[model samples]
Target chain A: MHTDLVAALDIGGTKIAGALVDGHGRILLRAQRATPAQEDGDTVMRAVEDVLGELTVSPLWSGARAVGIGSAGPVDASAGTVSPVNVPGWRGYPLVEGVRRATGGLPVELIGDGVAITAAEHWQGAARGHDNALCMVVSTGVGGGLVLNGQLHPGPTGNAGHIGHISVDLDGDACPCGSRGCVERIASGPNIARRALDAGWRPGPDGDTTAAAVGEAARAGDPVAVASFERAAQALAAGIAATATLVEIDIAVIGGGVAKAGEVLFAPLRRALADYATLSFVQRLTVAPALMGTDAGLVGAAAAALTRRNSATAAGV
Target chain B: MHTDLVAALDIGGTKIAGALVDGHGRILLRAQRATPAQEDGDTVMRAVEDVLGELTVSPLWSGARAVGIGSAGPVDASAGTVSPVNVPGWRGYPLVEGVRRATGGLPVELIGDGVAITAAEHWQGAARGHDNALCMVVSTGVGGGLVLNGQLHPGPTGNAGHIGHISVDLDGDACPCGSRGCVERIASGPNIARRALDAGWRPGPDGDTTAAAVGEAARAGDPVAVASFERAAQALAAGIAATATLVEIDIAVIGGGVAKAGEVLFAPLRRALADYATLSFVQRLTVAPALMGTDAGLVGAAAAALTRRNSATAAGV
Candidate 1:
């Protein structure tokens, strides 16, 4: 790795994806390991430490400067900590401090895992070269980030692009976010599986009831599967149209495990957008897939570090 | 007046509003006149000439350094010209040059009327102190502007906050923005009035059926009027919810004549937003009213000029 490279770490509930990214935005060194996520916050942090130790010992990484971490949920980017919803034991965890210690006191910046993935896409994946766009990860959960008017919007509390929680139905299911009929309740990956299971399609295993499985069943003419994806598509389309109207995004890039269903998810979404979008100024929009795969988080963290570095230089410190 | 004050002119289809605002964000002088909107382009420009002429002659505004004009409909802010739909024959009218000659070589900046209103609101109105918000005018024709992350977003074509053209229902109505089922077709003042009248509710003749009359009737316990306002309220609410998901706006400042119905329009609108929003992050939104009333345009124009002056200064002019 380059001597002045920035180290990036992706922290999730199940695993860790780490890499060293260069100035040209390419990954030169990498490491992966299981997360001690079921343990207390300290144990999970120790796991991150072990992985960073492995990367530094490897010959591939000659040198590393600072560190960038992408942590999960309700992040306070300015303060550099996170208490993600899915990760039960990490309430108000000082993630940046943990990673900084793991990297031997190297400066580190923390952002929400979802926002980091989107930043990765913008840096070198599907959304590269585009200034105004939205990046969504439709995996175990529905989450997103936005580069609007060429700037990132992390919100007052650093959770601006929580697209899944936007309610589509007033009389629909109650959500954990203290609302009813949110897009996540009706259309997220787990919800999609639940919808099929409720229709008695028995996809064998609960784990087998993925968005891709539903798409396949729908392609095979399963009414239940077709209805399920259409509902998801409709909710997603409605959310997209509303967002486009407000920010005038030029493109929307979708990623994550569920996005593997592809057109089953996008086709109906486009049709729904056409129905609700009345402005003829921009007759069509470009809604497609994210270029970054699983490594999105690591790269995004690197990018975040780079941004901080630039700001620091501009400030003459 | 500040020595470098710019004369601002806002020519809507129905009326002409002008002001000589100093660089300190103060309106030093103001005036208004009826617009002979039915007349052809040249005839209408003659009216603009007359109004601007009055501003130059006033003892409080004679030494203006530059000029700015705001108008409704498809405008090329870069080109300083427009084709205002409501102003009968204003097709590609040389509005900037005409005003420049009319004001004797004073430089001018032209923008969509919506952008101007947004600038005004952001500078010092209902949306003051907000980093992200929308200032919407739901009157004779729907218009709005977006303030995102503390800066204005005018888009590639200078129409970022054109909320009226947003399509909430594909099966809805036709809009002149060249699309069908636009929000304006169902939620604008004219549509509200026309729909109210068509439903057999006779409002006092005020040249058009409008949201104001519908608001009045709803206050008086007219079922039909209440339903009409509720319909518009629902549509506006849905649109606002969609917007919340994308931009993470903290507030939506409702202006224009129709918004004056206060809670008659706001109450149902808030309920609809609560029902339609999909994200937990986006649902925490607030709605308010424009503080400047009809004077918003003049104030907004001066605000735009002030920003331009600051930018030019920052650019070392």
Candidate 2:
């Protein structure tokens, strides 16, 4: 039996994951290696190469048509390079060329991790069937991607939907991104927990200062914790609303660690969304929890691969 | 010599302007009528019909193949209707259908005025060669449209790129649209004037308290006036930067009344843009004054018509 497949790679600060994905998005085979992110650029490339090596040795690898890599951004898809902040060694790294060589010259498609997740969500998760959507990951830092006019909008650099860096508070705190009051600065897990701590909310006897602890405190009716989460929700709502206004997306699917706050985050988010997304066209904008889970990055990379393959076929490549 | 042409309509609160535009975007003929904006829906429709009537009576009318309308938004291209805030008489008006019937069954394409301006700018103005751009009209009210992947992105309802309503100051003043700290709420012409006046910058002997007056004062080194324009520039910069961040546009073309403030607006805008567009990809974003002028709406409408006609022809419709 012959089956077409794509080699997918999800490269982040913590790990390098690769998979052979079938057309229906099923993972036929997988390999992973812990990323030596703090090491030199060659060390990181070695980790990615190891993952590809494992996939290449598989018998199913013969069915793979192309390679797709969804790596932590900011990635330059136009230049086939990446300079992820967390992976300091990979600045302006020629990742696509490296991956192409490792994969024996197969065609490659590269997108930011946020865009990849959006591709996965749009293809098989919360944003399925919706022609226009904004998919976001609100964890350590808020990141996002847009699905405009029913196609993934990875812009020229494959970093189009980097919503976290967009300023929601022009006169507020200065962000590490050099912008003022960016969404991630206000809504990320660390920011939420920090805001809670700064506002006098003490964590439980477990002394856990993570956003998860803050979320538990919020659920328990701690005023400061609740306020911090609400503030994060407000910022998130503002960013989401701004996105909908700019591009006419109808849904925003949020995932990552902070979204784990559940109703404590969602309730205020919806309320703030009402106030911000007040335009008739955007008033109906809805937010949903992301459904692709941990495998989203690999699945999304595969989705990008399939999309590129299909487009190439359509172009008679 | 016979040539294929399209009829274009630019509908607004004060006037209904119509033109017979050729494939090359030249206005071969034009007609206009004052809008009976305060009248009933039928009356406003009659005004639009009158403008169309003049164009229909023209000897060159036979060459017209379709009608393109760029109307004050929010227009619903998907529903073929409009509900512009200024034209209160026309709420959910069947504008596309009305134009289709008035033009004797010519196919009609409806788009928001901002989108129309964007088309004009992309086709023959400042954003001509840019593949991804945001064209803004910062006047009595701020409005905008987008060009993504070298095509107009009108979204489903013809109201994408409505940047005026997106909040940059989330906890700031409430906008009439029910959003807080919207770019328009702070950066529109009236807002600029109001901010200047509020800061105690009195008008000259002419007592003209317009944004233009503020611009003159700003140019004359009035600190309050300069501060006001700078503030507006800050908000506009934030919105523009946010747009670029979300969509990866390389340029922002600003047009309309406030833009006439010239360097008073542009100088500070460029400075503020640098502060907000901090990301590597977005760092190169450039802001330019729109070049299409007052005829931008009509020309843009024609551009949309031509684009739609070409697509339809390609699709063999």
Candidate 3:
């Protein structure tokens, strides 16, 4: 009855990672496999099974009484399914059932990858100790999750804090999600680089055309690059402020590639936040960079599994 | 003891109302008085006490177990103070302590008026049975509250869902709240009327330039008035979609003066929602008019008090 470890899986288009994590979040064992994202559903499930197979054979797996999954969404926690946009072959994949079968009927908890990252931040990273917060990953695409009332609010379908899709401009630009003026349409790393390129900011001799290169140009005082970042910052500020105005969050933690731009992103974001977070209760909101790094998804999955086990135990289930 | 009733107070700029409400949300006895909003702090407190006095004098008062106050914010449930914007004379007034002293020390619960109305909607009105919903009032100002995981989300300051001030158009227009293009600035009844008039819509022979008049004109095929309502609908849709995307609400219930515009607003709102709420998870979101009437504030306050009483009882307090 010394069940102090949880099994965790981080499934995305790029990889399928599994781990056995201890009570303090240390990974006792870890395994990963490249995802054949374009393959059939069964093939993807097999890769996931292979990764889990690695962890399951380890002695530490015996202590893992429950399993948690952080999968690319849109995830339907109610239906125990996921249909990640980047993985076209896995439409409505029954991930929870697959994982449960692979793990000898261990209780499996599934959440969107963004929600998983938020759980990590809330449990041990930038959002730690904050009762109400928003944790975001601004990369090639922007994604996020919310921590409300000292708990991770993954929502019914496990995609509660998808802030990137929320319209901040209402009429600015069309997003692939079929929405107009979405934060992702204007604020994602790809969009920032695109805006910079469109605004006549050429890449250096290396001919790199990514947001990271644009960040360099911005640091060197390139007006077009700086303006692009400023626009992205504005969109982010509006979205973050809107979140705070709606839910009264006190902090927003940003991670991912775009957030690595540091003060080039933070300075303008702080300025634009004042313009949008004007309501009295929301005026004191702050923003910080996320600290959980690349292992957030794995650790957050373990955290979710632990929380489920604890709650079930408390309820005498 | 037969402690099944709660005292409810609805404090606003225009009125101070009180009621003795049964566990079933029915108002058994009521009292009301005009709010001398411009008067000093003590005067406002006296008006509230007078309303409470009427409820306390009734023979049913002995059955009231607790008190709930739903006041125009910014009300700080944590600090037990309220500083309603329209009531400048009562800056940071300790209304909770005042009510506590007046009610002979009955345990009290305080919430923003928007939260109170949401509680009413969730408990007995349009949002009944929906675990996750946003209830909004779209009259002189747009205000809202959220129901998440089957409980009211009033936030730490009792002002979580102040969606009116959220910027839908971050750079469009200056708002009194210092935000640009806030939902209230574009969608409130006053703004709707102003937009109609500014766009060359004239009043009828009655010479009334209210939003109600504009609604009548739009119904009569006046393009200017119709266009203004459409604009307001667009802003509302963006804000509503943002709420759904961030929190995964299944329904949005709208009430108050402007909602009386009916199809003139709802038609365009539904169309715009289809445009903004495009994510797979949010696509199923529905919009409805609120069923609770003016008594929502009172009923919702009672609902909060009853919930508090029940939780306290469960905790054996």
TM-score computed on alpha carbons, candidate 3: 0.99
- Scored by DockQ, the top model is 2
Error of 2 at A246 (Å): 0.6
Among the numbered candidates, top lDDT falls to: 2
Going through the candidates in order, their DockQ values are 0.32, 0.93, 0.88
**Candidate 3: where are CA atoms >4 Å away?**
none
Compared with the true structure, what per-residue lDDT tens digits does model 3 show for residues B1-317?
Answer: 54699999999999999999999998999999999999999999999999999988988999999999999999989899999999999888999999999999999999999999999999999999999999999999999999999999999999988989888887789999988989999999999999988889989888999999999999999999999999999999999999999999999999999999999999999999999998889999999999999999999999999998999999999
lDDT per residue for candidate 1 within B1-317, as digits (tens), equals: 35778889887878988888877667777777788788898898888888887788888666687777778766766566777877768877788888888888876777778988888888888899998888899987778888877877666545678877665554355667655556677788888888888898986667545567778988898988888888888777766765665566889899887888888889888887776664445556899999876667887787777667667878898
Clashing pairs in 3: none
* Local lDDT at B235 for model 1: 73
Q: Quote the positional error of residue B191 for candidate 2 in Å.
A: 0.9
lDDT of 2 by residue, B39-113 (tens): 999999999999999999999999999888999999999999999898898999998888888989998999999
List the candidates' TM-scores in order: 0.83, 0.99, 0.99
Per-residue C-alpha lDDT of model 1 across residues A1-317, encoded as one tens digit per residue: 36558888888888887888887778887787887777798877777777788777867555676787877777766567787776777877887887777677878877777778778888888877777777888877888888765656666556667777655554467877666666677778888878887887667465577777888888787888888888788777655655565566667789887788877777877786665544433345578888887778888888878877777878897
